[model samples]
Target: MISLPLFSLLTDVAVLAQHGPSDVLITGLTLDSREAGPGIAFCALRGTATDGHKFIEIAVGQGLAAVICEEFPATMNPATAYVLVKDSAEALAHMASAFHGHPSRQLQLVGITGTNGKTTCVTLLHKLLRELGYHAGLLSTVQNQIDEEVIPATHTTPDAIRLNALLARMVAAGCTHACMEVSSHAVAQHRVTGLRFVGGVFTNLTHDHLDYHGTFDNYLKAKKGFFDALPKTAFAITNADDKRGPVMLQNTAARRETYSLRGAATFRARLIANEVHGLHLEIDGREILFRLIGVFNAYNLLAVYGAAVLLGEDPMEVLTILSGLTTAPGRFEPVVSEKQRVTGIIDYAHTPDALENVLQTLHEIRQPSQQIITVVGCGGNRDAAKRPIMANLAARLSNKVILTADNPRFEDPLEILAQMQAGVTAPDAAKVQTVADRREAIRTAVALAGPDDIVLVVGKGHENYQEIRGVKAPFDDKLILTEIFAELNK
Candidate 1:
């Protein structure tokens, strides 16, 4: 329903050469050739799987009004308009924003980015804003929201066309604030090209997504790119504890601020007590207790508090609402059995740093008599270098370890387990077990546990399906653990 003149969409795009009429009205924008039609402009994007340029002719044949590409077709269509740009993805983003009436400009958008804790930070901010009596929208890995209406999310950061559309819908729904997670992939692919963010938050960065980036430097660059793009009028809040955290703000023009538990920062907190129940902290000289657990969450809470205060909310009110707030789903969630007194923790700690953080937290607070039994796995077709590292860490930290399948997409699950087993040392090898089936693995971990022992089902937190050979079969770690506990009671 949003239509715009083709020339109007090229606001900041650098056109190498353009042909045909620039005044054609474009009603829709898409990169897929199959989605092209009358009044639609098709953007030819280069991707890992395939290039959109190959299907340009097919889109033109489907009656596309405009074609945006890096190169013009060998045989140009006389009726269709042609736009030659350096990057079609970036061009499409700006065009999509223009077509949607620049909805981001109408709302106070905040983007949180880092290897870990992005989901929790943004989710907390969204919920915190709502608790403060403001209509807020959320775009996160778990889901997208227009105030109370939930929309299923397919990607951590939606592509340009859909991203703008979501913002437009939020604007229409009378949302005054929007908080979203900005993935490194989004910055690399230019998915967030034309949006305006009032603030940006940086949680710590760790080893993640190396399979796509190919190097640690490349991955770091991608994360820093988000901060680099932030405008001078915006605020950049970072974790001073992370060594790389200060580096993220080096080139940023935004007002730089920091939050930390260890060193001096713009906002500071000290961990008074960390227990299985919750956390007690002295934040900025005020003593308060938080419902979320672990040291990582302490950092997360500080970042959330810093961003909220920077946004002009009263400090005491933010802390009041934050004390009762819970963590995002599948993040260190606990399920306990009453009869045996065994505890099961479901988490999404897929990376080496995250897994270590959780294990360390458990070790810090666990009773001396309790044994930590861990069940974990690595996904197929991802960074293979981390497979053994994860297995070794699990074996080193837990009393018992089970390596199982975690989304072996298009790869043999047994082979993936083999790679993981390669990391166990000789002394620790005896305590490690390899189970290719994730369900059976969880069952085995629970069965092996005694009274007061802890069982950790990690790697695929908040996911309800197991992806195998491109098929997502029904599977839920929390549900399975609960069922096992119920059967134990019977």
Candidate 2:
């Protein structure tokens, strides 16, 4: 544990009530009261759903080094110190960084934020840089990495304490550069408050996480907030094709740069060929053949390529390394049957825009005789506005659509399927069927496919567990699809 005097780590905080020693030492920091131990400082954060102030008393009783909150308790332990902060979350972030030795400043940190493509962009960049001989680290929804050591990721952006600890581990492991997906939740909650980001990338903005933000404008503000607070020394990279891309850099002090496929930008790419096998692109007058397919992935590649160029890497080598890179798991990953010529594609397309992009990519490349069958579902405890929209897109794009459950946390599986089925109109009703069981839905889709047919299993791409009623049971779409294919092919 790293212990420091209270004054040494204080940042814009005022001593409200000091009962005993003012020179009391703080050993560690935590936002959660359960983690409060002797000599640990507890930060009482006020959140939308729950107030951290409710647990400050418990921490103090447990012999916490100090109590940090916007409001001090009426009854304070005479031996424990109480400190007041303007913002509890912000103070926690600064405190966590100070306790961890400010590891972000020791490495070249690039943050990628948007509605989608964050995971793929950061994951690919990590792979690309590592392949180029740099000791790189990655933090994405899929996993976390410190050079060669892989750690399972529990959140898109971890809490301030955990984030600082992870960055410290990266620094200790001698990572030269690190790229992470900066979720909007992490931004609004002040998770990355004290971290220094050398660069930031905006992939795109769309309808997502409305369940938490409550409106589209609020969601946009949360994403734009990341760019707005960037330092002048850092670079702000955005997708030129997105309508809100330019708006993201409006108030930023950072240098602005753009990457696009449809318009002129600082970094630009053109699609030479988009086949099922892969995409051939003409990037900055140089042609590149990439193993990853689709227009969405094309945009992802441009974002990664642009960020690399902004970091002062060789343009030719970036493109060359980019061409050899493949997508992260569950992103347009294809598996074919041995006995039959049928193809099955896996993707994490939960949002309407993401779902449409995957389906459109398939329609553009498939043969006229091939029937496109899709198995898709919406996640529970999320933005419900996109459920019907996802259902409508599935019906409009595929010849046959199977609506099923995807991590129906507390909600009933049948209820979730019914909500999606509500989008099926009279004409669209003929192509749709409801199967509450996701595994059965996949089996049905595969059974219906002919030798030349293509099946698309969309949603929950890389996720291995199915969360139902708060229990995570073992369920992997990729593994299940492969097992069914082997059984059918034999």
* Top candidate, metric lDDT: 1
User: Could you say which candidate leads in TM-score?
Assistant: 1
Model 1: per-residue Cα lDDT at residue 241? 96
TM-score, per-candidate, Cα-based:
0.99, 0.98
Q: After superposition, how far is residue 180 of candidate 1 from its true place, in Å?
A: 0.8
Which pairs clash in model 2? none
Q: Tell me the spans in candidate 2 whose CA falls farther than 4 Å from its real position.
A: 12-20
- The per-prediction tally of clashing pairs is 0, 0
Candidate 2: minimum summed lDDT over ten consecutive residues — where?
11-20
How many backbone clashes are present in model 1?
A: 0
Candidate 2's residue-wise lDDT over 368-474, tens digit each? 99999999999988888888899999999999999999999998888888889998787989999988899999999998899889999998999999999999999
lDDT per residue for candidate 1 within 343-440, as digits (tens), equals: 99999999999999999999988999999999999998998899999999999999999999999998889999999999999989989998888888
**Ten-residue region with minimum lDDT total, candidate 1:** 1-10
User: lDDT per model, in order?
Assistant: 0.93, 0.91
